[model samples]
Target chain A: MTEAATTRRSRITPEREAELYEAVLDLLREVGYEALTMDAVAARTRSSKATLYRQWGSKPELIAKALRHNKPTSLDEIDTGSLRGDIHAMMARSDDCQMDRDAALMRGLFHAIHGNAELHQALRQLLIEPELDHLNTLLRRAVDRGEVAADNPALDFVIHMLVGGFVARDLIEDRTVDREFLTSYIDAVILPALGI
Target chain B: MTEAATTRRSRITPEREAELYEAVLDLLREVGYEALTMDAVAARTRSSKATLYRQWGSKPELIAKALRHNKPTSLDEIDTGSLRGDIHAMMARSDDCQMDRDAALMRGLFHAIHGNAELHQALRQLLIEPELDHLNTLLRRAVDRGEVAADNPALDFVIHMLVGGFVARDLIEDRTVDREFLTSYIDAVILPALGI
Candidate 1:
């Protein structure tokens, strides 16, 4: 139909798209994924609902874009020579990244993802996949540098430890992920687990 | 109110109460926590809703009773002579005490507990508090035995590693807890983390 064609034709520049995505993150932090609506996002960003619909197609897609925008890149790249130093730097980088409000937002996102397959997939792609990729890159570097064995049995457990530690601290213990905990975790658990 | 007092006066005996609680667990596993109701529990147990109401005031309370009934008791009394043996046994016990169709029920419970504060408290008391108490007791024993120093730096991290490992495997990886993972986890991570 002509209407569908018009909706598809109205495209914004990349700069405006990034601005809208940033606005979505702000809204997500303020209102959470469950309470967020396209109307609210459009109103906040001074855009139209039609524009959002044409661009993202659905609420999950919109929230996925927002999560991707705010996704932490603290562990992207670090070459501290030794595996211990690299892990130390990686843990320290994530120190200031822990926000109490973020935990609430994460809980909201988690609730949104449960029972909704589309949202779950979108969340894994935007949020979970990126972190996994970054950790893989870091571990791959360690393997190449001969810091850890190429076929280390504990390699699989490292990622689980990092993520599990944070989630358990937040959800179970109801505490912020602290720097002291991260540092000792690296020295005591991570390095030893990986047999480095 | 007089009605409330009258309702409280019609309490059932402990044996009948246990039967009703078991029926609630069956309904929860079969139909899920969200779909579960007092009527369904009463019908399943061949009891009246009045008796159910007299025993437990709310749906959350009923579910809490079911959880308490099914909770593992050995997790609290893990004194296997050594800290390593105690932790290994504790972690491995999760594999033996299996619940039928529990994964789906747990997922449903996770969703149900998010927004409901009373349910959250009840779940913490029924599910989480027992495990925490057991772990705390084990750690206290370790401290008393001087196997681990009183000023052990990685105590919290070790606890997190053990508990977090299983939770993450279940929630994120969608895997069942097994003894092999638990043994490797204790040997590779917990032992070194405690400098054993």
Candidate 2:
């Protein structure tokens, strides 16, 4: 525990904490990770620097946790019975606007993640691994039910294809990723690769 | 043309110009696009700042051109008479170390591209479009040969899949993309999706 945590633990309510995380994400979207400052977060959230530091310890910790908080769905809980259904449900969880915001936020984080090892580790721990594990479970269920081949190589690239779909939208066509595009991509590229 | 073009367009030899571009790319890999400066390029290449600015007009133009210069293969020129062979040749154009360096350089550029509209336009015009056109030609040839159906929806995602394969390697498995990995991915994921 840093100086802040030892002084005040659990002082802020969960509702207030969520608001703080939202503020962090808002700043991230507006200015990106490199330009974002602890001072800015404190001012945006109307919280003391001491409180912010006490709660999160550092900027990477705060940013990583904020990203985690922004994820509205727990992927592990999404079970639609079929692999196709599950994948569609996962994409449908976020609407068009939310997906756009998420894409920008992710683009903002990519540079910081590349430069900062601490941020990278935090993200892998707090954000990426959990989601990967959840998706793995979803795929494992597909394999169990014989919806997909157990030894299929395309299985390894499912995440890459999905992520590339999201990241490439702006670069390829200068378009925003929406549920409709993802649905078509799922139907066309992903399913065909999996031999579904 | 800027003052550089009018003043002395052909003063720098082709070999010297290539050396300058290589220095710019080395600086990009070291300090990233955000921090790269004309002064640094001049100092590193033993050229005057005025000459550097006059030649390239701006950092974005220089960086974009450097990236184009660094591409050892004219992807358009790779005609192996088979889509698989063409792709494998594309991946094999650079050795393993070059791929890792290119990946790092690309990761560096991602943040700069997000923030700088000017850099983004230069990159799109000078770097991305040419490559896309080349890949499209390759795909078109494959269509002509009946290796892949023209109407296949996966045709639209071919670039996205290949790019995702490059970008996602570090993100997912923390691995440097090599010829073997890309070859396997092409055989397993891309080829199967194209129904080859």
Candidate 3:
């Protein structure tokens, strides 16, 4: 409704968009998805509702973009010549995974994501798949280097255990998943399970 | 509010309460937590809102109780002597860890649990901690039986691996955590990590 007939659009600079995404994630951490509204987003970003809608179409798309923005791109860059080294590096990346903000963001998404098909698919596709793919690539390299058995059945779910440990640590155990904990986890649980 | 003037209340039998819990879990699976309401529960159970309010006092308590009621109590009774047998039995218990209903309940609770202090506390106190205690007891027995090292560092996070594996199986991996899969998990990942 902001523009019914005009095809021309004012281009938003990447810097502007980045600021907007940050505002969205902050609001997501504060209010969560069920309570998150486009009006609130527009107000926080100091932008028009029509502009927001035109850019993202819906709340799920906006939230998904925010999550994608926050995700670290170090997966492809992780190379330490050994599977053990790669795992330690991957687990130690200083992303918001261990931060309170990321935990809040995850908790915000938990309940609303169940019946929300668009949100579920968006999260799996954007956030979950890339991490899994990276793990697969790492394992493949290990196999190539003859460091691991190619047909080890544990290889299939090894990523899930690591990922879920971090995911459930707080929610289930009320324990903080810090770097020290993850490094110990890598040495004790992960490498041993991987047949080191 | 339904009966501010009435001081007298009718006591529902344990059987009726179980039926109501079943109804709550079913509605949770169907409509999820946000869309689920006391009215929907009342209608589903053919009961009055006042009755539910009197029983659990709130939605979170009701959900927490339902989870507790559904939990497998055989954890205390599972004594296969060896730690490996105990873990295998624990993992393979057929409470439908893969069933869509339980998954839906988990999904439904994911986002709603955060920022909801009442619900969060209810889940931890009523559901999560009991399971953790059961695992602890099982491990303690194993330690005394000399089946596992008393000072093994891996014993600390071993529960996390088993738990995180099941929790993330469907959501993260899209694979079923079946008996055969868990059996292999016990052999390949669990035993090796535990040095069993």
Candidate 4:
């Protein structure tokens, strides 16, 4: 291996990367994106700053990757016979506490994403696009089943609606996003829009 | 007038309060909620720090009151014979540039709101609840007109959907929240979900 490759391989094993990412997410939850620092992450993980810089490049990129790493399952792995069943099955994967924590993490990230263009680009490319592709796959299956029409404009905004439901709940009602709420939202708002 | 009234009248006239709130909003846009301080507002408006404290009580209250003052027209005054007309008129009240500025301001506030309880309470009490009350009036009109069922679950979530549209546009699509996008979203996602 080249010297650069040798250094990278020595520094970041799969387990080590996972440990670092967990530290990053814990710091993210504690202090949020604005207050979090590379120095903090390095100290938390007992790694050098140079190692983190070599591994992740920058704070935004690190946070973006950490968030991506935090997802419990790939949306692609979820497959149920019906679109409604698929959506509910997806929601069922996480318990209430996990959903609450993930919602809180996302709330902070949304603001950071707005302010930082690099973070926004990294998240869209690394995290968002992949999930969207997975969601589109689900939608494609639904369309093929003739559950939703091909010309439905609501298909274009499924992510927005889902994300919106997650976000607007706290802002408007000061409520924790839970499976009950998501299930109700999916049925009332999402399904109706899709003409299901 | 009592001594307290005299002191208050001397420090702040109606016009002076408007000037201070305008300065506060300008600073909020430039620096965001966390960076904005009473000292900064006092400096910008040429008011005493003591006077500001006595008037607004806290930063959250000041920011919330300023946001309330920034509204162009009350939602209650926005009756246009039909719900669709009222919604469109509300959209038309602000031009594209103003909408862009407001949406960006809101995006920053959403993050701050998630973290700050006092700010959230002030905003809900001073800004959000009043708007929701007005929106409820609009929905009530629709229900009375036989346009929508009062029991529809989506009725409870119109604000969520609207707020989500404003927020999710930037995060997901990386697009500016414009009239065209909102119009399409309303027609496709919101209206259909409402069974309108």
| Structural similarity to truth (TM-score) of each candidate | 0.69, 0.83, 0.80, 0.83
- In candidate 3, residue B106 scores what lDDT? 61
Please state the Cα-based DockQ of model 2 relative to the true two-chain complex.
0.55
Winning model by lDDT: 2
Question: Residue B131 of model 1: what lDDT?
Answer: 74
Return the lDDT, model 4, position A166: 81
Q: What part of the reference interface contacts, as a 0 to 1 fraction, does candidate 3 reproduce?
A: 0.53
Q: What's the TM for model 4?
A: 0.83
Q: Residue A70 in candidate 3 has what lDDT?
A: 65
- Per-model CA lDDT versus the true structure: 0.67, 0.79, 0.73, 0.78
- Candidate 1 regions exceeding 4 Å error are A1-62, A65-76, A95-102, A111-117, A143-152, B1-79, B96-119, B140-150, B170-174
RMSD of each: 5.7, 3.7, 4.5, 3.9
For model 3, how does the per-residue alpha-carbon lDDT over B1-196 read when each residue is reduced to its tens digit? 2474223234777688788888998887676666689999999999999988987788877887776666544454888988888877776665555444545666666666765766667667644676788788888998898877888777788767766666667567555556776677667777777777
For residues A1-196, write the lDDT of model 4, one tens digit per residue. Answer: 3688457658578788778888888777666676678999989999899978887678887887776666544554787889999888877877999777766666556657767787677657655686678788889999999999999999998888888788778888888788898898999898899998
Tell me the native contact fraction for each prediction. Answer: 0.36, 0.54, 0.53, 0.67
- Candidate 1, after superposition: displacement of residue B86 in Å? 2.6
Chain A only: list TM-scores of all candidates: 0.72, 0.81, 0.79, 0.80
lDDT of 4 by residue, B21-128 (tens): 888878876666765778999899988888888877788878877876665445548878877776676666667787777766665566688677877776676556
Candidate 4: docking tier: medium
Which residue pairs clash within candidate 4? none
Candidate 2 TM-score restricted to chain A = 0.81
